[model samples]
Target: MSFDYDLFVIGGGSGGVRAARVAAQAGARVALAEESRYGGTCVIRGCVPKKLMVFASEYPGAMADAQAYGWTVHAGGFDWSAFHGKLEAELDRLEGVYRGILSGNNVTTFDARATLADAHTIELSTGERLSARHVLVAAGGHPVRPDIPGAELGIVSDDIFKLDALPRSILIVGGGYIACEFACILNGLGVQVTQYYRGAQILRGFDGEARGLVADEMIRSGVDLHLGTNVLGMARAEGGVRVTPTHGEEKVFGAVMFATGRVPNTAGMGLEAAGVELGRNGEIVVDDYSQSTVPSIYAIGDVTDRVNLTPVAIREGMAFVETVIKGNPTPVDHALIPTAIFTQPEMGTVGLSEEEARDQEPVEVYAASFKPMQQSFAGRDDRVLMKLIVSRETRKVLGCHIVAPGAGEMIQLAGIAVKMGATKEDFDHTVAVHPTMSEEIVTMSAPVRTG
Candidate 1:
C-alpha cells in the first residue's frame, strides 16, 4: 500500500496542522494544503483578531472608570487605522509561526487547496495530484449572508478586519456571539451600532437569567438592539447600507454586516463524489474517531462540524493522530467544554444550562447577582452574576455560569472543578477570595431554589 505520502491533510487549520505536525513527528510522511492563510479562521479572522478588538473596545470604559476614580485621564477618538495595522502585523507573525510548525516537523506544506480525488488520492488546485494512506479534511467555514434581495451588499465578519476604516455606524444582523460581540466592539469604538435579531433575546443558548442581564446591559450601554426583528432586505443608499427591517422603517448606515451562521467548507471538495458521507450543511460525516464512512478518509474541526472550537479542533487532531498514527484508538471527549462570549458583559459557561439540567433531573441552583466593588466605586450601574447548577441526587456540579468582567478567566478555573465532578459541598468547603466578584461562587451557602 505505497502512497505519495502517509497522510495528505486538506485545509491547514488548527486541526489539520496539528494532525500533520504530530503525525510527521511520529515518523509518518505527512503533507498539508491550505487555500488561504495558514492559521485558518480562528487565528486569522476569528478569535485572535476579535479579541484584540475587544481589548481596543474596552479602553474607553477603562478611561471613564479612571476618571471616576479621580484620575485626570482624557481619551480621544479611536484611530481604527493605527490599531488595524498592528493587528495585521500580529496575525502575520502567527501565520508564519503556523507555517514554521509544519515545515519544522518535516510535513510538506502546500499553499494551494486540496480535495479528495478518491479514498487515497488528493487533487490539488496547483495542478498536482497525490495519493496518501489517509486524508484529513480540516477545511474550516465561512460566514454566510442571509438570503434576501441585495444580500450581497451586506458584508460578513470576515470583511470587518479588512475595512479601511471603521464605519460611522453599523447595522448588525444576527443575535449570535459574533453579532453581539461586534455590536459591543463597534459601539465602544463610537460607531452608532444598531443590532437586529428575530429571536426573543440575544445569546439564545446561554442561561436565561445571564442572557437577560446581558441584554439589559447591552441596552444600558447603548446598543440599539431590536429583538424579534430582522432585515427584510438591504441596498446601498445615501449614507451607507439602506436596510428594510421586518418590523421598522427603512434606515441607512455606514455598513450592514451579517453574522447569521457559517457553512462548512466541503463544497466541490469531491467528498461525496468519492463516497464520503456529508451532512445537510455539506460537513463531512465522521465517526467518534473522526473516520469517515470511507475508512481512508477522515475529517476534523469545523469541516466535521464537531465541537468547532479551536481548542476542540486541536484535541480532535491529537486524538486522530493517536488513533491512526500511534495505533492507539482514541475518541475525542466533547463533554463539558467551557466557552466565553466577549459581549459587553462577558459570558463564561461550562456544562449544561440550568434549563437543560432541569429538564434532565432534579437540580439545585445557587446564584448571586450584585455590583462588584470596582464598577460600583466607579458609580456605574453595571452588575455581575455567578451561578452553579448542582444535581440534587448526585450532588455534582452540573453547570457553572458567570457574567461579569473577566468571566472568561473565572470560568476557566471553575471549569476545571466542574470537569473534575466537584459537588456543591466541594465548592462550599472552599474559602472565598475577599472583595472579588468570583468569591460569590464559593460563599453562596444555600441553593436559591431546589428543583
Candidate 2:
C-alpha cells in the first residue's frame, strides 16, 4: 500500500515521542502530531513541575533544620512569581529537547491535534489528512472535575502550574496521591491548606501502615485533613471560594482545587468511528502487544488505561516498536513495577501491599517505625517506616514499602531486590548501613506478625 509514512503517531507524550523517535531511527518513515506542548503531562504540568514545587516547599523545613543543627539560617516568604517564571522556562527547555529528539531522528512533527480517520489514516486539526501503514495513539490523559455545582469555579491539577500566584489558603479535594501531595506541597509553602476526602482514609490502595503514617505526618505538619467529608458545593466569595462541606459549616478560602481523578484523552479522536473498541472509561482497548481491534491501529500509555505511569508508558512504547518494527513480538511486563508517591513524608512501594499479600497466601510482615536520627536531632517529631512482606512458604520477599524522607530513592534499590526474587534471608544476610534509616530494612530478622 502506498502510504505517506510507515508510522503515524498521535500525541507527543512520553510514549508517543519515544515510539516515533525509535521507529524513525530504525529506518522507518514516521510522523507525529501534538495538539499542545511537546513534553506532555509529565514534563509540562505533572512530575517535573510538581517535583520542583516539592523542592521549593521543603526549603522552609530545611532552613529550620539548619538552625537546629547549629547553622545560622534565615528563610523568607516564598515568592511564587519568581518560582513560576523559572518553572515555565524549564518546561520550555524540556519541550524543545523533546522536539529535537523527534526531528533529530527524522520523524516529521506537526503542531496540531491528530485523530484516526481510518484504520490506516490520520486527520489533523489543521484539516490535513495523512495515511500510514500503521498508526499509534498515545494521547495521555487529563484531570477531570466531578459534576458538582460550582465545579467550574474550582481548578484542576493542571491549573496549579499556571497560577499567577499561590493562594494564602486553599482547599484541596480528593484522597489520592495527587490530592495528598499537593496538600503537603501547599502547606509547606505556607498556605493554610485544608483537605477533604470522602473516604475513610487517603491513599486508599497503598500500604495501609504507610498511608497511615503519611496522614499522621500531614496532620502534624499543619494540614487540616478532614476524613469522611466532602464538599457539597462551592461558590465564589469575596475573598476566593465559599465551600460547604457535607459535615462541616461553610468556610471561605483563597482557592479550591480538585485532584479528583484523570480520564483518558480519547474523546473526539475518531477512534470508535474507525472501529477501535473503547472501554467504558473511554480508554482504547489493546491486546498484549498494544494492537487495537483494527489491525493497523495501536494505543499505549494512559490512553490504554493500563499502568498510567510515564516509565510504564515508555516501556510499552519500546515494546510496541519491537513488536511491529523489529518483529520481536515483545509484550510489556506490567507486574512488579515500583512506584513512589511524593506525599509529605513520601512513599516508595513495590510488589504487593500488606493487604494484597495477605489475601493471596500465608504471609509474614516485618515492619519498623521510629524517629530517624536526622529528624530527631532536628527536634522534629517526624518518623520513618520500613516494612517487608515475606511469603511464609518460600521466604521470598513479596513486597517492600518505605515511608520516609528518601523513601523514593531507597525504594529504587529495594525494588531491584524484590524484582530479582530476593528472599528474606538474603536481606538479613546483608550488613546494615549504620546511622541510616534504610538500615532497618536489612536488620529486621523476625516478623512482627504472621498470618
Candidate 3:
C-alpha cells in the first residue's frame, strides 16, 4: 500500500525470511515479498522434502538389516503414490509455519513477485511499488537443464518431488552431489539406477580417496555408474525413454533425471534497471559484508553463488542485519563451513580437504577405514571412513573428513573445534567417551599425523 518501510526483503526464502524477522524484531518496519510458498527452496522442494524421501528410501536397506537383528520382514512393498502424497502434505505444513514465524515477528508478508524499480524501490508484478531504507534479495536458485536435442524429455531436481509415482528404473545425469544422492536413494529403494557423470569421479571437488570410497559404495549398492560420460540426447520410446551418450552406447529407462547444478534465480528481477552488478554466472555481486555494488541494495544465499548452503545464507543474512541495521559489525568467515552428503555412508567434512590443505602447507593425512563394530555382530558389510588433515609443522588439525553413518552429526561438533584452530594434540589429549562411535575422533590410538 505504502512505500514507507525501514526494510524491504525480496524472495521470502531461508535468507530473506530470517533477515526480515530479525530486522523487524529490532524495531525496524520490515516487509517481505514471495511469489511462491513461504519456506523457500530448502523447506519446500530442496532440503526438507528431499531428505524425507532419502529417509524413506533407506527403509528397504534397513529391512535387510532387520533379519540380522532377528526380525522378519515377511512381505513388503513401497507405495510411491502414498510417499509422494505424504511429502507434499508435509511441505504444505512447513510452508504455513514459515509464514507464521515471519508474521509473528511483525514482518509484513506480500504474496507477489518483486522487481527493482530503482536502488530504493521495488515494483511487484501486480503494479504495487514498495520503497524502503534497505532491500535484501534472497531469491534462491533453480536447477539447470543442459541444452540437448531431447532435454525436455527428462526431469530436473524440482520435478522429482512432484512425481505421481516413482519409476521402476531411472537414468540420472550429472556427477554432483544431487545426482549421487538421488542414485543412492533410488537404488536403495529397489529401482534399477544408472548414473552418468561427466567427470572421471563423481564429486570432483572432494578428496580422491573419499570420492573413490563413495563410488565403491554406490557400486556395491548396485548402482550402474558411468563416469567421464556425457548425455547426447533423449527420446521417447516404448513405455520408457531412450538416452544416447556422447562417447558410449544408448540406454533406455522408465525415467531420466538431470542433476547438473543450480543457477541463481536473478533473471527477470529487473536488476539491470537498478544498476545492480551481477557476476558472469548471473549471480548477484556482493561485497564481504553482503552489500551489492549499489550500497543501498544487498544480496545473500544462492542468489550470490557464494557457498550455496542454506545455513550459510542464514548466517550471512544475520551478518548483514547486525552490521547494517544494528550497528554491530560482523563479517562472515566462509572458511571451514561444514557440508554433508546424504548418500548411503554419508560424507561430512569441515575446513580444507586433504588436497586443498596440502596445497597451502606441508600436511599429514590421518585416515581410518573399518567395518563398524555393530556390523561385526549384525553381519552387515557397512564400513566407516574418517580422515584428519594436519599441518606437518604445527600439528594443527586443518580438516576433518568422514564417510560413515552419523557422519553429519559427528562432524558438526568437530567443525567447531576445527574452526577454533584445534591441533592434533587437542584431539589426542581430550579424554574420549568410551563404547561409542563418536569417541573414535578422540581415542584413536597412535598418532596418525605424519611429517
If the candidates were sorted by their lDDT against the true structure, best first, what order would they fall in? 2, 1, 3
Pairs that collide, model 1: none
What would the per-residue lDDT of candidate 2 be over residues 1-451, giving only the tens digit for each residue? 7999999999898999999999998889999999999988998989999999999999998999999999988777899999999999999999999999998899999999898878988888899999999999999999999888899999999999999989999999999999999999999999999999999999999999999999999999999999999988888899999999999799999999999999999999999999999999899999999999999998999999999999999999999999998889999899899999998799999999999999999999999999999889999999889999999999999999999998999999999999999999999999999989999999997889999
Give per-model TM-scores.
0.99, 0.99, 0.97
Between candidates 1 and 2, the lDDT winner: 2
Please state the error at residue 436 of candidate 1 in Å: 0.9
Worst 10 residues of 3 by lDDT: 442-451
Report residue 157 deviation for candidate 1 (angstroms).
Answer: 0.4
Off by over 4 Å in 2: none
User: Whose lDDT is greatest here?
Assistant: 2
What are the per-residue Cα lDDT tens digits for candidate 1 across 1-451? 7899998998887888999999999999999999999999999999999999999999999999999999998788999999999999999999999999998999999899888788999988989999999898899998998889999999999999999998888999999899999999999999999999999999998898888888899989999999999988888898788899988799999999999999999899998889999999888889999999999988899988877799999999999999999999999899999999999889999999899999999999999999989989999999899999999999999999999999999999999999999999999899988989999999998889988
Give a tens-digit lDDT track for model 3, residues 359-379: 899888888887877665778
Q: Candidates' lDDT values, in order?
A: 0.93, 0.94, 0.87
Give candidate 1's root-mean-square deviation (CA, Å): 0.8
